[model samples]
Target: MNWQSIKEQLITFLKDEVKKTGLTKVTVGLSGGLDSAVVSVLCKEAFGENLKCVLLPSQYSSDGSIEHAKEVCEKFDISYEIVEIAPLVNAYLPNMEHNKLRIGNFSARMRMSVLYDISARDSSLVVGTSNKSELLLGYGTIFGDIACAINPIGELYKSDEFDFARFLEIPESILNKKPSADLWEGQSDEEELGYSYKELDDALKLLVDEKRTKEDLVKFGFNSELIELIDYRIKSNAFKGKLPTIAKIQWS
Candidate 1:
């Protein structure tokens, strides 16, 4: 995929986008995962000392996640801050009958809320870490991890994100770990999605990028069940990729 060339372009995009916003600095929520790590390195290359990595861990965050986030910051010699959002989340959703998904979504929003506030305080923009696969399938929390001023990796698939992360020499610990939002203990992204990113990304390429039909996908030996699931996800979650819909009314 010519990761080196792509990486250079993303770095340029980051720098140019931040400048367009009249902001010289950027803040990212480092989740101790491949996507955030890749974005961190790219922003570091783009903004140098102007990039700030904020680790917003909730109660569900793993200890290893926090440590790995710190390692990335230290490895890149980038500025960082650790803000615990558990207290804030608890205060907001206390005494509620929320399930894992609900609590997880709330936590995601809380973390993003902190990131935006930090961006305002630091006079920086929020650089997103969501990859194309997640965005395509609507696998992220709306107005949460999906919120950002500029997304350098949103166009790359999950598999491509890992490839780019490795090219950037992200810590092996992060690259090797199972992908997760760290929304709760014992939670894994693939487990929740019921498919590995490789499988999903492969299908996505055929369906979205190549504009293949269901019949064509079946001819390619793709499972009908998986195809339907992926198709539904793409259609249903398409809203996550667009602006809010508004109805137009005739004026007198």
Candidate 2:
């Protein structure tokens, strides 16, 4: 997939976009996941010493997550900060029982809130790490993981990210781990989505990039229900991918 060319272009994109903002520094929420890991590498290549990664973990975050995130920062020699979000989450959601989804989403938002604040304090832009696969599937929380001043990896699919990640020599431990948002204990992207990234990426490539119809996808041997679910997710969460709606006034 010409990863070399793609990597070069992404680095250039990050540099150019941040330049437009008149900011020399940038921040990323490094979660020890594939997408964030790859984005951190790209940012390190682009911003070098100007980049700072913030590790915002909550009570639900596993110890391995913090270790994995720190590995990326130390290995790359990138500056990083660790901030726990459990206190913030517990302060507000103390009684919000059993609804792990709500807890997870709130945790994501809290992390982002801290990230944006850090970026402001450091005079840096927030770099987004969401991949095309997750964005298309509406797998991220709005104003949370999905928010960023610039996204270098937004176009790359999750499956393709593995290749790019390998190209950049991300830690094998990170590359080998299952995809998770790390919002709660035992949370998994595939388990919740009911499909592996490869399966989802292949279908999205056909449906979005190739603009194939659901019927055509079925003919192409995709499960009808899978195709249906994909279409529904894209339509339902389409708002998350866009700017907020505004009411128009007709005063000429």
**Best candidate per lDDT, number?**
2
- Listing every candidate in turn, what is its Cα RMSD in Å to the true structure after a full C-alpha superposition? 1.0, 0.9
Poorly placed runs, candidate 2 (over 4 Å)? none
Q: Which ten residues in a row have the lowest lDDT in candidate 1?
A: 92-101
Q: What shift in Å separates residue 203 of candidate 2 from its native position after superposition?
A: 0.9
Give the whole-model CA lDDT for all candidates, comma-separated: 0.91, 0.93
- Model 1, 1-252: lDDT tens digits are 898899899988988888888879999999898899999999999889999899988888999999999999999998999899989988977555767888999999999999999999999899998999999999999999999988998889998777778889999999888999999998999998888999888999998899999889999998888899898998999999899999999999
What local lDDT score does residue 31 receive in model 1, on the 0 to 100 scale? Answer: 88
Candidate 1 TM-score versus the reference:
0.98
TM-score of each: 0.98, 0.98
| Prediction 2 global C-alpha lDDT | 0.93
